[model samples]
Target: MGSTASDEDYFQRGNLFWFTVITLSFGYYTWVVFWPQSIPYQSLGPLGPFTQYLVDHHHTFLHSGYWIAWLIHVGESLYAMVLCKSKGITDSRAQLLWFLQTFLFGIASLSILMAYRPKRQKRT
Candidate 1:
């Protein structure tokens, strides 16, 4: 079989996107649930959707990590949909929310990765 546009030459680049998101979202989710200090709910507001999700799913979220992880997981899925679109994996089909979600996540992922990269010093 021949390669399709969606097959994509930028798989590594795209995967980097996914890895970054999964890592950050999953990490944040874990921390938020287990260590609310990981990301202060004050910023997003405890009454926000994620916190509400945590409260609603009290049984499974008994532990901070699981609840937080789930929150991240939902966000990431939405992210992945857009990642697919922006990367040309597929047409976004005029879906505003999908496009917005993908675009936001992609931008955030890149920004977070840039922020977290270790700085290097010249060894002259």
Candidate 2:
């Protein structure tokens, strides 16, 4: 018996998705890290509502955005790990930069897990 899945029916395994996620992070970090001098800050122009709010509220916005983005990255990393398990895929770094990404994400995940532990309690 021969069976094939259509493009729509086909989906990537967990490892592939996690790998891709890490790869993208590696590339992003490399771009900003190695090319710090070459990278110019993109100007958002005159202070708009967001900038105005940040101004009115002070520098808290900057810290908030920074931390929020970091939290999001951490969440995505965890999601990738879960996805990898769900898809039964072995994740690996295709490039050296991926190593950095994995390490960084791993640290963040560990820190979060250490700070918060959730356990399922059996209903007696």
> 7-109, model 1: which lDDT tens digit per residue?
2222222346666776676566556555654444556765456764674567354475565645664665566554544444333342343334434444444
lDDT of 2 by residue, 56-121 (tens): 465555556546766776665665454433333233431222223434554433333233222221
C-alpha lDDT (0 to 100) for residue 4 of candidate 1: 33
Evaluate residue 1 in candidate 2 and report its C-alpha lDDT on the 0 to 100 scale: 8
Question: Which candidate leads the pack in TM-score?
Answer: 2
State each model's CA lDDT, in order: 0.46, 0.41
Error of 2 at 73 (Å): 0.9
Record all residue pairs in model 2 with backbone atoms less than 3 Å apart, i.e. clashing: none
